[model samples]
Target: MAGTEIFGIEEIKALTDVIERKMIHRYGSHSVRNGIYRVEEFEEKAKKITGSKHALALTNGTAALITALKGLGVGPGDEVITSPFTFIATIEAIVACGAVPVLGEIDETLGLDPVSAEKLITKKTKALVPVHMFGAAADLDPFMEISIIYGIPVVEDACEVVGGTYKGRYLGSIGKCGTWSFDPNKTLTVGEGGLILTDDEDLYFKMDCYHDHGHIHSKAHDRGEEGKFGLGVNYRLSELQGALGIVALDKMDATLEKIRKTKKRIINSVKDTGIKVRPMHDPEGDTASHLIFMLPSPEAAVNFSRAAGEAGTGFSIISQNTWHYAKHWKALEEMGEKDIFGTKAPSYAAETMAATEAMLSRAVMTGLNINMSDGEIERIIRSVKCGAKASL
Candidate 1:
């Protein structure tokens, strides 16, 4: 079961055909044209889906975030507020841009708490990254107000909630700029890709340069004449990946619909099982239902999982904490003394200490993929309810 895949053979075959036909590398050959075309198509499709004026295709979601942060002029000594209960890639991007990530707490909906975010802001605060974690939009109105009052930028990490909406506006489009991931595990995939969407022309131009290595191809380049303007990374997506993205983009609406239906069914099946369903915002708005979540106490979740196994109903927590964030935390801890940024001065930065301790204390999380079948979920729910009685 661990090795069994969720996607069907047709999906794999379709992706493979695109990969085979497009033939990967497009740096300095005619194949570059096809890659560029596919990327353009993906950008256009994404823009329409996200309701943004401009979209840029990039290497991966992390690159999209770093590009957005760099474009916003975030750098060393600058503090950007973000939720700690997210994939480390979000924090990694902040670190890569030489900015400090001031962690914020999450609400029941699992998004950054607007009040908590406001408390973390300071004179050096430069940006706010509100991740639409697990497919639910964060309460954006308050964050938008905070950004407005402070004159700071907001970049929505809509990676997991691309098609999700809040208050009628699309999740990513609600911010100054939004970043999305197209990894295999995401709501949609291009094998490996990302997109950045923005309404600001200047931000669009700057991010283009950031992703491309500080270079913007002239109109001639768009028309097939090669002249370098500056330096940029070769963080461009492959034609095959772009093609696959286009195909996937076409299927997004139906895919998201199925996800919503599956989510409802699973939630109903599990509601009476004495296991807690993950909290969510009103599903009527813009939840893409990316990953189903549950917030059982750690002990309860462990017991439920064990009982599930005995009943032949497999399930798992998000991951063992030892395995989930160890690499990132270990890398930070190894920095040692002077390397650990704020160690030398204990009482020096009260805010930093408070934020760090608060963030670390509230890190428990659990998730289920969107691929579970109805029967499997029902069986698991049955097992959980039975186990709850047995424990009593």
Candidate 2:
């Protein structure tokens, strides 16, 4: 707990030194903007690692989702079914594309419940945005089946998960388009950036052009050196970020191994504490172990968090009710009787009200940082045991 940083500051500083020395090209150059080159390089490495045909880097994770949603033709009147237990960015991206976001309950994996998800689908449903919550991939078999049945595209919100594998296949590679965030908190870090991966040629082209500025000759460069007719923003990563990304990618295997070990330690430590640790459903493959979470009774969870923090254990509430659910409630209720997201209720109003109640009453989330050392895990366990004892 003493000066245990989530990531090595010295490592980042070393990489930054290389950038400052101009050993690496900076982003935003005429030939290859420092940002553009870095983003492109990161995407290339991502493609190679994930086995995807194309990769596009955008400004941030939210922008990446927005780009994918827009590229997939999700617009006004279209609905995208996604789990409510996710970051608002997923919902924001859908809203940005003028699409209605449908709320689906989470299953064991804390991902979209296939059964509940199926109930939400309708003719207006355009895509499925299954978030790999806390680096754990959702059950893709049912998601894939639903996609095939409804003929809708799948855009995976894999921002938190980098190396998560589901059913022997990579999480991002299974969907039509997958977006990843390279924020420092994620499994991988490129300072602050996001990437989109896909095998679909058309979708790739649209996203590629959209990230750059609406118009850029594939082989050469943009027609207008000064400006362009197409549309795009400065959603690019610096070459420096890319170089750091390369270094980070090299350590992915080691990072994941360490994460798994830590997760096991934490899970085992809490086994007899009576606190129900959430299970990561990886029936097909391995989870990235981004954040180990638990959904204990709200009151107990609060007390546990307080005790842990006092004991020098870092405890975080990853999912705070805040203002996200209200927007989701309104969006879902506005869907009318189309049933774009599965619910027993006949209209969006009924479903939203019910979902709102469920989310408010329960929904506890905690995280285990990948860099957590054994001592930290022990401290956390001791705190949880103490809390459990108090409850008894």
Candidate 3:
């Protein structure tokens, strides 16, 4: 999961070039820029890789998400349906735009359940953010169908699976707009960066100016002379981050390849002991960041964790993971959106999504590493095998 594990001369060279140039700003310093624009280059590379007609680099993934949401005209009182099993940034982005964040139930893929999402949609539903959780595709077919029928745009959150694809299409490029994170934990780490990809020219231009003080960017005009589109925020990516990102794209393939192969090995080993591995919609397209097992019951999942510990490895149950699971999000409860918005804040109580909760409670998972050694893989395999024998 840590792309930093494979860092070498490429990353160093990128940083050195940025330091030597002394042009840390992304735009308008033409005199010292030396005809080098790493941020633009990074955006070009991102567009080519993701097949997006336009790509905009931003300060972080959260910023990208917010920009995309705002670009679609989501604002006060509007509803955006997303999965409860995603990073908190997804919810925060909606709130940042004064939109109501609606949490939908998840299906087997550990993403938004399409049926539940459709039921939640209304006239105020402006977007359907189907997060590609744990490096696997959500059941996007139904989500996309609902999007087309309801005329709501889908903002695919591919932050967790940077280089992953869905049915041969890149995850971020599949929806109306896709967003990605390039932080240290992602497949392509630039230390801290985010990207937005879209084919809609209007949306692209809107986000571009909105991320940079609402100045309409043009090569012919100087930075200060550019026309203002509207009020905007400084979610701009720096030249240093851009330089890091250019080289980071080159490292993504190797990281993803290693993750896919190693993840398959671990899953195969665990499945042989009759442990049910989480199903994949498009197995070949998965980034394989995580290998999940669905135990027969929550009690069995606890035993499985003990088995993993005994084998000198670690396993996590989402039911207990406060950071990612919505049910445990005390921070959300504390914020008390119910009073701020007209409708009640969406509930995260276990009973509200009983089936999804049951599934989460019976599940244990481990993240795959780009730097996992063969010995480490074997050690995890042995842990599952031995653990299953004692626990199951």
- What lDDT score belongs to each candidate, Candidate 1 first? 0.67, 0.68, 0.86
lDDT of 2 at 42: 65
**Compared with the true structure, what per-residue lDDT tens digits does model 1 show for residues 13-79?**
7567657665554334553445445667778998887778999888889999998998888877687
For model 1 the local lDDT of residue 35 reads 40
**Against the true structure, what is each candidate's TM-score?**
0.80, 0.80, 0.96
* Backbone clash total, candidate 1: 7
Candidate 3 lDDT over residue span 148-246, tens digit each: 999999999988888888888898988899999998888778889999999999999999999998989987677988899998999999989999898
Which has the greatest TM-score?
3
> lDDT winner among the candidates?
3
Q: Once model 2 is optimally superposed onto the true structure by TM-score, how far is the C-alpha of residue 20 displaced, in angstroms?
A: 5.9
- The all-Cα superposition gives candidate 3 an RMSD in Å to the true structure of 1.5
Candidate 2 residue lDDT tens string, 259-287: 67776676677778666655656733444
Evaluate model 2: give its lDDT.
0.68
Error of 1 at 174 (Å): 1.3
Off by over 4 Å in 3: 335-337, 341-344
